[model samples]
Target: MRHACFLTVGPARFRIGSDWRAPIDQLRALYSDYPMDEVVPDFTVRLQATSALRRFVRPQVAIAGDFTLPDAVPLPLHHGLLAAEMAMNLQMALGWRRHLLLHASAVSRQGRAVVMTGVSGAGKSTLSALLAERGWRFLGDEFVLLDPETGNIAPFPRPISLKNAAVAAMEHEIDDDSRFGPVLRDTPKGTIRHLRPRTEWIEQMARETRPGLLLFPRFGFPRAVRRMDEAESFVRLTQASTNYVALGERGFDALTGFVRSVPACAIDYATGDEGAELVERLWSETGAGAGDRAAAA
Candidate 1:
């Protein structure tokens, strides 16, 4: 059996298996991995993935391979890189609660979670990167978890993926060479990197926050920011969500609850700087405040 360890983005426990190890030695060596101060034990999630294709079916958790790659053909590391994410989505879809699977980039600040759902070219990654750089807690660039019961969002803490022009922007912004991993060549999207979030935040990987805002970010001319109605937001979000149709009535209830509770907006910006400022203003507007909210149910 192959052995590897990962820190997932939900509430569960410290899981163990013949194929994995915990208290990640490399992560510990690089930086002190400590739990968040306001630790919520109940929200913690720990699980293992034994199947490759099945692992890529979810949102939050990811997997790492121990086997050596041949020099001739580059392995599909990114697909494998997101195994945990796939697992998270699968777990949520099958779990008891009804959640609308949204295709969005999500993050947290103060105490609230914000999801930015958009199509492939809609600057979701760029916006997410901007938020992460501007002190917002990174939830995910590709997936966001929403709790059906309280209309709150859960953390899907994983690496921030940057592609094409976004990569250049990040390279220009950060000084540290170690902050990024080796650039992979020829992905369907483009060349990419697994961006490392602040070590302090990574230590708090087990932490989950509530859903406070939903935004459909668009990049184009006449740059401006506008608030979207909850009803319209719900429609768009439902479409972007991964397993909305699969979850049925329970999923609809969860989505409606989320739309009602969280403020939804449409962010229009051409540049990352403007996008970052818009998010900052939104964060301040929301009552994220100082302390963390209770973890999702």
Candidate 2:
């Protein structure tokens, strides 16, 4: 490891060490708002070169960490920052026990949260980022932290990874150049850029919101909203959750309870404005009850 950085997101902390300084420098800049811990990190990510000569030649970043997939391939040196972020997420997905991790995006308004999950192109991240721009607190963009015991959604608002058209969508909303990272082309997810979560949101990470609603949002479709039955919602969530099976009975109880507790909706929208309108209407109609429950959760 040539350079290293340590930071914490929500309850999970990470220490990322890289053979090259550029990636570590980029990670440090992107997560500069976060505080480093003196205590041991929950997970460690090492971005090392495949061979000694590769360090000076076309460098490769091997994603070695505390928890990792065996078949994972090394990335080019230019993608070190992305590798670091992915490494951190990998650790939480494979190892964390404090919370039931959902591959979902979340946003909160006045302490009531909306957890949205779907397939890769679902646009949940875009929706959550758009909602945050319109005054909703951005809870998370990658994984939403759900405490199985308490059913409270803790804030895990890491930098939002925007892809393809999503980048232009955000550019239309936010004018802050500082929040937007460099637009890197020809990546695994097409053109990619990261949007740093607002400082106020990070400062208020201590506040936990109860899940008021569950959304399975799809973009590039006509405006439509459908309610999901408990059975349907449960099955969908089971597929979306990375550690539901590992958490065993506790995960089952929490997820089942969440399904029964919150209303579930599947919304289709062609644009961000339409998505925001639908979310506002739904929140107004049912957000109060959710807020009340969050206090107790």
Candidate 3:
């Protein structure tokens, strides 16, 4: 805990303490656009050595904080930044309650948000990142915050965690090298890198958009789109949410209302371009600019 940094992403604030300065430095650089006023943090993350001796010799950064997983493994000191990012995600997944949290990626256009959820390799992250660069505003790539009462999308524009092929794909799409964090090789998810969201998006993180379209995207598949019924969408979203069960009645009401209000689809694409194009087509068909739910219905 020798070095520390504070960050505010959307409505949540985080205080990250590290045994080494490298990870803290990386976070500060990557999140330079975000507010760092030392306000009270919603969650605290610690990147400490696994043991006393481990601090100096073969240092491994253990992710410990307000909430932690029992079987979480420590990362080598070089991958401390990834460890910090993972820890922050862990905190939100386990601790956050003000909003229903979905394990999804989101982007907004014309004041309406598109929430995309899928399995890890489903390319939701890449598709969202691609859309953000093209024209849409990046909401988040990890957790998509859903306001239970208002049924709005809260923007959590943290840096996009690009893994393996995604790192190269995003690198090809984005020209700014400085917007990227250090390339951490051979992590649990393979060679990983972080891409900071555009400054405009970060500055506008406080804004919330109405959910317009819900998507379940699957990568490496033949191009196709299937309309998803409310029942299937509701069931899938419950499984997608991290704090749904914890919120009980509030969660149930919020989720049911969301599925009823927003139109959902399952899209399969073989490439990022196809996925992006498909989303655009779907968005246009949904009449997101008009904020009309009936169009999808």
| Each prediction's TM-score versus the true structure | 0.69, 0.95, 0.97
> How accurate locally, in lDDT, is each candidate?
0.61, 0.87, 0.93
Point out where model 1 deviates above 4 Å: 1-7, 11-99, 285-297
**Models, CA RMSD each:** 8.4, 2.7, 2.5
Q: What TM-score would you give candidate 3 relative to the actual structure?
A: 0.97
lDDT per residue for candidate 1 within 1-297, as digits (tens), equals: 344333334443222122233223323332224332333322223333435553445422233222211231222333433333333344444342334557788878666777888998788877887777777888777667666666666665556677778888898888786777557667545676667777766766666677777778887645777888878988887788777877788778988888887777888887888877777777667655334333221
Between prediction 2 and prediction 3, the one with superior TM-score is 3
Q: Highest TM-score among the candidates is held by which one? A: 3
lDDT of 3 at 4: 95
lDDT of 2: 0.87
lDDT of 1 at 23: 20
lDDT of 2 by residue, 3-68 (tens): 888888877788888888999889878988887765698998898888999998999888888998
lDDT of 3 by residue, 1-297 (tens): 699999999999999999999999989998999999898899999999999999999999999999999999999999999999999999999999999999999998878999999888899999999999998999999999999999998999899998899999999999999989999999999999999999999999999999999999999999999999999999998999999999999999889989998889999999999999999999888756464454436
Worst-scoring 10-residue span by lDDT in model 3? 287-296
